[model samples]
Target: MKFFCATFAMVVTSATQAEVFTYECDTPPLSVWEVAGEWCSPLESLKNGLLIHQVDLCPGWPPPGGQFVFYTRSLADFDGAATFFVQWELQTNGDSSEFVGVCPASLSLGSFGPVFYQIVIARDTAKFHRDDGLPNIYISIAPDVPHTYRLELFGADLYTWYIDGMVVASGVPEGAYPSFYPAMNFGTRAWRLPNTTRWNYIRYGTIPLDAAGDYDSDGSVDEFDLSFFVECLLGEGVPSGPGCGFADFDADGDTDCDDWVAFQAHWTGPPAVPPIPPPCAVVGDTNCDGAVNVLDINAFVMALSDPSAYAIQFPNCPMSTADANGDGAIDILDINAFVALLQ
Candidate 1:
């Protein structure tokens, strides 16, 4: 079944001081998601302004994959942590009959009956299931915090999971299942007291996983990326396509100077060993001399006069560095701006 592209909503959380984009599901309603048992509360709003699904008694039906995210945290200090899952359902006589939960934390594949693939995440650990040949692999994380969980199904069979911003696990399911869904159940081994699983929101769409401002997917955000970003910004190169989403460094759904500020933070190096650079650094400092001066002014003039000639003369300098006004365009106005900076 074809899934509709995602629509995003910008959200600000005062407590965490973080900006988030929530993808709202836009698919035609199949049915109000099935509740597993009586103890489970159908999706509803609570006094705390969070949408919750009380998984105290039953396992709810899992929803299918599209690009989306769900912010979840356990509401009660139960004996065991609450569990959320996605499963593959096998077709029987042209209709789904058996369910195999992927990402199973406490359950073994096919132990409960169906031959299946699954990935299970619990409070402290994550588990993966593909087939009988490979042993289930587990990755551990600190539990019970309001961390962002993201899942993306791409290529032929590749599925990847991300917690916060790091990829924790990814693999292709061994046997092909016609469809997938998300499920929620309280506890790993047994049902616990009346507890809640709070959801800030469930976004449906491909999350932008590329390194912010690293438009070329290279290891670092540097001069080359800056050039590409400026090209897109000025509409001079490839029309700002979906691929340009990587430049949205602030995650505010737009590529602008604000994002440029965040992108500059990574200019020192790759994410692993990022050394913070000073603030108020000028974008037009093309000479690499730690200051914007007359030398940069000359460089900008040469580049503006004849880009091809300038490229051959100073092959090391990126033409984008001369955009002193941050307007994503290089022209005489930038020359004037640079002179003003020198003044």
Candidate 2:
């Protein structure tokens, strides 16, 4: 019962943040995926979603090795907090350590440091590995049946794992993996046994576990978040641009009425008045002494020629003020306008 309550809490938390990426596996995932060994192409299926049949194991020790591995070609990679959701099934479970699994680990063997988590069917049972085997938790999982798995990582030290909407683990200590790329594999490189796995879908992203509608990230849902919420309300369509995430309360790719409903639930009246920040420095006034003069020339040149140096020299000045032409960028194009401003 405690586990069920934890599971519900996790599900609710996850539903509040939008998924950054998803692979349905209904068609070729070539745009996002790279595969090794004899992994068959994804095929469309009505009941199964998409079926990826892992062919017989590889023959030798080098190169492709024994396992059939499919991993993303590239990843933006989440920082601080992340959530991974996958619906899949192992069609065959072998007697040996032959297994099918998904994890946030590099393809290479020697990469060190903690991995966020791993979910696998190794010896005819499902196992979850958190933060590089802090400990392994095993549970009974039947072969040839699809199950949804959710793993949520909070910062570097807390995580929760769920299987088919039930929490198997929660608040597990995490050692911080830094960043991760999702990977799915069938048969171990060590065991070399064959198995077929079907992946229905996979979705992952950075998610805020608290303050679901806090747009400015000031830690409360209040008046300041309303404008961002209104801007992100796209009804049934996908929300775009920055700050849309703040309004995606249902995490369904769209900021619709449902999201507005959720957003209202977190509303905490008007936000507290924040302390005044340093004023934005005038353009060409790189020294930020409240005047644009010849004395600003050296700093202006530094802002143009050596941005990093300028940043160190004028740590309090706004970088945007360096955009002398108001072109919204600090580049060689701004030099002419800055020189004219000096004259």
Candidate 3:
């Protein structure tokens, strides 16, 4: 009944190039996972402008049995707003699966090519029920900041939604999680995403992982990694195999789910994972086995250069300590040290 959200703090990148804010949740006081973003884009269409309470989320996260929740207040698009919608992303690997959240969706009164926004109410919450039946959950953004957004989603015999900190809506869509119905997604086909919309005070809360390093997509890593690993044993992909980032928990160049196991082994508490050892005389016990091995060593390497990538490699590993050389926690200095060891 009592769950903690991911502790996140926004990292306002650059106002000139959009930014992402982060805050940590479930740290003790208020374990609410929250991240905010103010950017244009990051990847191809997935700009680095990831919102807070959601931006820094682990890709292909929540594994299978896991659950996740993010809140975006300011979501703006590039091309003229014609009516935008976000996809749940059924499968980042190849399925390109997706769904839409339309109820709380928005409509713009202003005119802006690349802009959108929303705000999180104080007493907003999502309640889960055992029954199957729910309405759409979405908020309508307007110049009026003092307004409220009500939302609800249905599974099958149950609905999930909260109103002003109350379970206004409850039930699961089709009696199954979105994972079960990869193709099912809500949308705002009725209204269009005008070229302009703004949001503010966005908040989020959730339990992202059942345990650390559960990147196998089955939720928990444990022995399941063997299955996801077997599936990608011979595969080769950056961070992840053909399945995207599900099994590449430790990014040790080996496609497997063991990464999730290692992450769970030393998570200190929270959705985070174990930490990869430093690059110096440091032990690469990233898996928290208290020894230096391929997993630790490889994860250590990723730590020096790419912190996020490093986290993905060894989810549980303390990526904060990735900086071996100490130039700046997991900076070029650490990379140099790691590479030196390779040479």
> Which regions in candidate 2 have their CA more than 4 angstroms from the true location?
1-19, 36-48, 58-67, 81-96, 99-112, 122-124, 131-133, 177-192, 208-343
**Ten residues in a row with the worst lDDT in model 3?**
89-98
Q: Please report how far candidate 2 places residue 328 from its true position, in Å.
A: 58
Residue 309 deviation, candidate 3, in Å?
16
User: Which tens-of-lDDT digit does each residue in 219-273 have in candidate 1?
Assistant: 4565545544553342223234333466666555545556555666667443332
> Which lDDT tens digits does candidate 3 get at residues 1-343?
1111234333222222212222222232123322322222211121222222221223344422111222223332112211112111111110101112221222211122211122122112211222223333433222322232322222224333433323343433342222211211111111111111122222221111222333222233333233323334443343332222334556565543354345446334333432232221243344455554555665665565566776565664455444445555555656556545444
What TM-score would you give candidate 2 relative to the actual structure? Answer: 0.45
Report lDDT (CA) for all predictions: 0.42, 0.51, 0.30
RMSD of 2: 17.3
Quality of model 1 by C-alpha lDDT: 0.42
Weakest ten-residue segment in model 1 by summed lDDT: 89-98
User: For model 1, how many clashes?
Assistant: 18
* TM-score of every model versus the real structure: 0.35, 0.45, 0.25
What TM-score would candidate 1 get against the native?
0.35
The regions of model 3 sitting more than 4 angstroms off are 1-46, 49-155, 162-168, 171-193, 197-319, 322-343
Q: Which stretches of candidate 1 lie over 4 Å from their true place?
A: 1-44, 47-49, 55-119, 130-134, 175-194, 206-245, 248-343
Top model by TM-score, which number?
Answer: 2
